[model samples]
Target chain A: MPRYGIPEYRLPYEMLDRDIDVITSLGVKIETNTRVGSDISMDQLHTDYDAVVLAIGLHLGRSTRIPGAEHKQVCKAVDLLRNITDGDKFKLPKQAVVIGGGNVAMDIARSLARLQKQKFGGVKVTVTALEDRAHFLADPVEIKECSEEGIEIFDARGPQECIIEKGKLKGLRTWKVRSIFDEQGRFAPAYDESDELIHEGDMIIEAIGQMSDVSILGEQLTEDLEWNRGRIQVDDNGHTSVEWFWAAGDCVKGPDVVHAVADGHRVAGSIERWLVGRQK
Target chain B: MTEGHSSDYERLQSKKSLAEILEVAVEFERTARDFYTNLIPKVSKQIRYLVEELAEEEQHHFDLFSKLKSRPDIEQLIQAMVDTPASDQRFSDAIHLPDLGEKPDDQAVLQFALGREHAAMEQYRSLAESTEEGPIKELFLFLANEETLHKNQLEKLYYETIHSGGV
Candidate 1:
């Protein structure tokens, strides 16, 4: 639990697994490969355990619905990072461009830099974001590493279209971002026409954000549960409206590993306390 | 807000004069080095090592600036801290002293690290703006880039500390 000065952000999947093993060894039971809503039914879980805490994370990547976004070379930033961390190898293009300015975008950019160095002997990566450099949501350190690794950063550029020629990705065409959010704080981007740039790249990765997949909750349970925006609603203790069920992690709070751990602790304590109250 | 002094400093293009810039850089590096050195004794051995490493890096910057200052084309100017008078004597009187026994909390340490990185970034930005020479501009830009990287590293540490619910 003491992660002081530990490089947990860029840790490999196997290292995370090992860390989980260490936690499990400390008398906390951990189940693996058990897919909820598939491996077991909700009714069955309700009958077996007093409370079911859903700690499933946000895995679905937000996509840019620009023209030619369906091109094969265009991939989600999250997928690219996950694949690279899984030790998978592929022949990347001589030049690559990542779109977005979040932490995940930086992670992919840095990961690609490492790959580029190992294979090509130099860095040829570019990151384009809608926000100005100062307003970028990504931790400043990520931006710094991307620059240090020789990646060019083009700020205040919003993707207008993904250029494709003869079934091959040629580059991306973007307009100057006038503003990212609307007056109402919604995600409506205003672009400037006079300022436009075409960034040449064989591959483009989108890292805007991610969303939860609660479809497995089924229509009945989903309708019965309280809602907040598109996420399932839960109390402070990770309790759902239904007494037998709970939800936590990225599915409830979005993507963050430490948050998931905290959510797990809260739900576990709540379940234990509820069970004890029932016994009394 | 001495308008005449501000105008004079602005016109001098202190940024273009490697010697003048180096003087300010040396002073900044010395102050940061002193801060870290003094901070080391107040913390645990692990944190002390980190602060010492930072102090050494600051010393390296001081040495680099000193070498730059010795260049023939360089001209000496009063350091920024000396030129701009502030109520807080800590800014003016701070020395490159060794660490005392006051260990800062994790947040405080992170704040210090952030301030250091911000100063380095600002210094490089000023250097970039003042210098017209190509090589000197490039050098300043490169240093700025490096400072940004350091800033990021510190920020990651800060956020991770917060994520861990802080000790």
Candidate 2:
């Protein structure tokens, strides 16, 4: 059978780099190390360039609403992966509990397992998720690898709180999940409180989801921009409510390489037509 | 000396089922992804393009293996395969990737890509040979061919970068 899902899947980092090379070769100018509304200023870029496409992706990994969620010991899965990718030799935790069931959670769990195996000569990582094994969002192969690598996974557990004692993260407390979705298929988790369990660990990682860093929009622009259900409103062609500015990528939609790619093409096409209209 | 981590990693590397083979394939792609993406920001502008493209190719391979990983037989096959002994590859520190902040230019990136593609191609080739004519065999051959295509692309790109006065 043919491999890959809709619109074909390609790695993001690689695709961006190679495409940048191709585009640069075609005489397009690109700049890096310039953060929007910070280093270079988003308003400046908007005014300087004829058309601006905000393709910033959702980089901040989501954290659960629980006490001690803001504790230093609690790490975002994206941050952990970013630090690892950005070459940080972080002090490896002896025991870690990753709270999520998605692929990112599996990845962090395995990554921690590798670190723990190196540090203490064994894996002491646990992954807890609200969804049962049958409903886990991570690929089965990833789950299998997690078992092979000695990382434990517990399903049907809803994270109720991050257990912190004396301002130190001690563990993650969770109740048994009865149902993850309601009859309407919405995320309305029902937990069995009597079956509460406190999983002991030195470190806690959150990998539920990710969101965009739109702080760079500044207070005024953020207020001016129209939002759809908390996301920057954009049309099917990625055109925003305001002309001369467009939004796409994870910032507009959610995470997925395919969707981001489609957004890229759409934005490019829209920009082309826009510039053409301006010229005429 | 803590050879345990490396050894355990090698154990994970050992293929037991078609699923394990595909999983191993995904892991290698991840390693390649890490290696190349890390190299991109650190390298000079002249060579960043090459490293980025190489990284992209690794991610592409990762995606393919990921698709292969979702086959119907894997869930059951892995349970039984876990009991088998680990492979005895001498170099066990494969998981300890080089510090990406340094240690690679254009040529090095290409060479790394070449190494990864070669190893994966060989694994897939052997797999294809061992299996009887079926969907499984075809998958292995396809993966192997994918690697071959990458190998060729890297080789040509390597030549271009080298002879073009800047890599």
Candidate 3:
């Protein structure tokens, strides 16, 4: 996450490399460009090593499935962030509309705003979310910085459709959300049909959420494993159903740096205990 | 994974009656309660309470569905016309109880329960996503969110039970 998912501004690359240097200093082997389930099979790993830890996090960005969302201009925040980190070429939109009200959304918005500023000497980015300002899922600091960056914020707006003119992307059509949850506390968002607005932009970014790409586990391993929601099921100690295999980090739990680090410790402890028991 | 991402959103839509949906949901809860109750004997003494709590939570969900089924407002929605073969396939298909095998450890049992809770949450989420915005959608969304919260709670309890100083 620190390497590619997070922006350089938030987490400097030098600091990330230094932390990696410390881990490598301790004789830990780090491999790059070696894709698991492709370069090496899980069965081979089980035979070669006593344990296998799968910490493949949520790398795929989710789509809202609204009409016109399949357009090239309608990008996922996760993908955009990764592209920016990889130094890949991306067209900076003159006006962009971002959906979602989380830290990632803010990151994308602010990042794009900076890019636009550099390219055009101005920023025209709009962020719309289902939650009102009182209940934004984003950190207060992120929200504040977005305004400081001169990005527009529209709270409680539920995306209905992506506006496309001819073959090009236009903007997003959204309605004001009356309530995000029902009396029973469900995620069913009710919108005020009368209160609607079309935010004009050439690009729309869906920063709603992300999910782990489990296809890398291969078909057999996926079927053999237990899953919760869409994540591989693991015990409190991060042990998977398969005795030799274990999963932790964002693959088992959602995104959170502290939680991921805690999980790393938890899984390490479990592996240590197992190794000790094996020795005895 | 993200909470609402489903590839089969369109295919998951049911033509079954609202009453049928409630029936299947209630049955799901009942089966979950039974599953956890069955696990109680397999788990260790220290974590037996966890199984009991899980079973109780399922019962509470069942009660909520039952109450909703009896509500006067729900009757109108239940009778609304929608065409398709009626079957409890979705809920029934998702109901797979984990095999604890012989001499189950605390971690094994907790892992099994976590799997069940996650499956329950996923099923409800799919239902919520497939259905149009309405009371029924709200109902399924509510169930899904409840399962999510329950899953989070169970994760916390599992850590406290399994870890020494809390990772």
List candidate 3 segments past 4 Å from native.
B1-167
CAPRI-style docking class of model 3 based on DockQ: incorrect
> Which residue pairs in model 2 clash with each other?
A14-B56, A37-A42
Candidate 3 clashing pairs, residues 3+ apart or interchain: none
Q: Which lDDT values do the candidates have, in the order given?
A: 0.68, 0.71, 0.78
**Which candidate has the top score in DockQ?**
3
TM-score of chain A in every predicted structure? 0.89, 0.87, 0.96
TM-score of candidate 2 relative to the true fold: 0.57
- The residue-by-residue lDDT of candidate 2 on A75-114, one tens digit each, is 9877887676555778788889998887778878887787
Correct interface contacts retained, every candidate:
0.00, 0.00, 0.00
Error of model 1, residue B153, in angstroms:
36
Interface RMSD of each: 17.7, 21.3, 13.0
Evaluated with lDDT, which candidate comes out highest? 3
Model 1, stretches more than 4 Å misplaced?
Answer: A1-9, A12-15, A26-29, A181-188, B1-167
In the range B9-37, model 2's lDDT, one tens digit per residue, is 76766546655556666787888788777
lDDT of 3 by residue, B1-167 (tens): 44464534533554667777678778878888898888777654434566778799889988988898988888878865343222335346756665678556555666666766777777778777777788878877888888888777766544333321111
